[model samples]
Target: MDWRLKRNCSMAPRQLLAFYLSLCILSLGIATMFWFQGARMIMTFAWIELFAVGLALWVVARHATDSESIVLRNDRLTVEVANGQQVERVEFQPAWVRVEPAHGDQSLIELSGQGRRIAVGRFVRPELRSQLAQELRHALRRWQQGAARPSPV
Candidate 1:
């Protein structure tokens, strides 16, 4: 069985662009009205609001690409995590990796072996972390069964 997991991104680039365009048009219209009313302070407030909104949207957009991708193939279990611009990857021999929760009952899945470790399931709901862990463990077992390499230490 092949295993892959990723976060559900809520926004797309086209949607984000449309949102920005609409927001800009609305802000310009409102600011224009205020400008014609002799309220000069409105422009500063408008700019501040635009900045705030842009910053907030940027954060949401950045997170849209944030995700965890896992693939188990060819005796290797590859894990990749994308958080904004930074991405972390760890590869392990399927026979040696252990999958467990990071904490007691409610936490992310921690995959460890060969003195290396990586946490996953952050995109899954807290209540479903256990289920995700179970799934990973099952996939690991399947991968190990078909391997012909020397036993893991």
Candidate 2:
């Protein structure tokens, strides 16, 4: 079984880029009109505003794909978290993994075993984080039970 969770992005990176391009064109066109009218400061301020907004949008686009994936296959449980440009992947034996909230019921879910720990469920709502933890625990339990059953020769 596998569970994949991702940020709910209203605008994709391509759509965001297109929107920024249109905004730049409109702003620059207006600034050019002001420059022809002898309001040179408007053009300068327009450039500054565009630069600031572009930087902010870039940051948003960078994290648009942030997500967490948990996979249970064979005897291993793998968790992968992607945040901005960094990705952290951890694997554990299903029998030894622990799933719980990091701080409280509304806090992020923590998975720990073998002296390693990582938090997940950041994209999930705080009210539903405990449910996510419970689902993970159930999946791990099922995996462990399946692993323990005997197979025909």
How high is the CA lDDT of each candidate model? 0.82, 0.92
Query: How many backbone collisions does model 1 have?
Result: 0
Report backbone clashes per prediction: 0, 0
Candidate No. with top TM-score: 2
lDDT of 2: 0.92
- Residue-by-residue lDDT tens digits, candidate 1, 9-101: 666856987898798889978988999999888888888898888888888887787788888877688898888889999999888999988
TM-score of each: 0.88, 0.94
